[model samples]
Target: MFLSTILDKPVCQPIKKPYERWYTFMEKNVEFWLPDSEWHTKAHCARVLLLALLIGHQKGLSEEEKDALGMAAVFHDSRRHDDGIDKGHGSRAAAYYKEYCREHGLSYDAQTYYITYYHDQDDSLGLSEIAKSSDLSEQAVLLYQIFKDADALDRFRLGPDGLDENFLRTEEARQLVDFAKDLLQKSNETNA
Candidate 1:
């Protein structure tokens, strides 16, 4: 499979049958700073997006919430500079997401922005920020958790201890542990 470095091209090939549409959309639409990044490639974002949607559905999230989750997933690591501890990548991605939405004439979702901004931070910090914020809704908090868990699920690509089920924010995510692993394996095979 030939991956394109052009910003206008799809970031990667679709990973799964059920998620092809989303994978294609995100791969084509989202902008990655490091298109050649091995760890934070478009395939990783697509898997995270799929996990987020599945977990959101299980949690009975509204269409709007799911949309936010989708946006959060695709943009979460868009600004990552390295595969290691790139601490402020989330904030950079959030800023990019805001500008992207504005330029594309899409609705700017605060929930999505917040989720993206704080995703790389500690869970306690994110939760506390949500709790203290006057503008953030309870739904935003849940979306944050869902997005975090969804991103974490894709950590299987990191190796054996990449994912710790106990760290998963939602029960739905915890339940998807085996499935997440399988998804990673299958996606790797497809990409291979």
Candidate 2:
């Protein structure tokens, strides 16, 4: 088969030694520098990657873009802790990605050479720019949209008690966002 199809054995995680080290350092140190909010947690980033990969794979993103999506998820908020807000997380992510690529033998630039550009909701236009700059047709924008919305879904909601009304505008994101909002409303009622 041209594809691996169902679970074929694990080839292993893609990151090499230097890449692993840089990530380890970044993960270990990023939190103390960030505010103690749900927006800056490692767990949040992990889920964002999972959601991106789920949508990307379901939609058949290339192997490189798939890998870049995960890298982008990790790096999107990598620099937010340092600045006390998400001010330039995308560019910071880009710089960090470039450093990681250079430090290792990787052959791509985080900014100009990859399909995934790590961006926060605070950097929505950057997300739009990355999607436009990529080789995706209109349909593939759906993949990027999923990633963007999924991350936004996580940010504006946290379990059954968290919901943000403004995020429910798009039909694509409506189901997830509405479900969360309903759950939050139910929980509030129950508590009341």
In candidate 2, which residue ranges exceed 4 Å CA deviation? 1-38, 82-85, 109-118, 121-124, 131-143, 156-192
* Model 1 TM-score relative to the real fold: 0.87
lDDT of each: 0.82, 0.50
lDDT assessment of candidate 1: 0.82
Which 10-residue window in model 1 sums to the lowest lDDT? 1-10
lDDT tens digits by residue: candidate 2, 1-192: 111111122311232322334345446544333545445555556445544554555556666655656666666665565534456566666676677678777766333323234344433665566566655445434545665665765554454434463653345455455533443344334435
Please report the candidate that would top lDDT against the real structure. Answer: 1
Per candidate, the number of residue pairs that clash is 0, 0
Judge candidate 2 against the unseen true structure and give its global Cα lDDT, from 0 to 1.
0.50
